[model samples]
Target: MAKSKVEYVCTECGDVSPKWAGQCAACKGWN
Candidate 1:
């Protein structure tokens, strides 16, 4: 069997990551 993964990104910043964050480390947003 195979597994699927989800991706999360900050709308304020163009940080495409696998986890969700409160603030974008690059742009620093409260998203």
Candidate 2:
């Protein structure tokens, strides 16, 4: 298998950030 860039998107809002935050800045939730 080859290595690919991974990403995490917020469920509440379509905010694609590099890392996870305590509260989603987009959704404003503890996700």
Each candidate: what lDDT?
Answer: 0.80, 0.77
Candidate 1 worst ten-residue window by lDDT? 13-22
lDDT of 2 at 6: 77
Q: Estimate each model's TM-score.
A: 0.58, 0.51
Best by TM-score: 1
TM-score of 1: 0.58
Tens-digit per-residue lDDT, 1-31, candidate 1: 7788887788886788788877777888878
- Across residues 1-31, which tens digit of lDDT does each residue of candidate 2 receive? 9988777788777788787776778778666
Candidate 2 regions with alpha-carbon error over 4 angstroms: none
Superposed Cα deviation of residue 24, candidate 1 (Å): 0.9
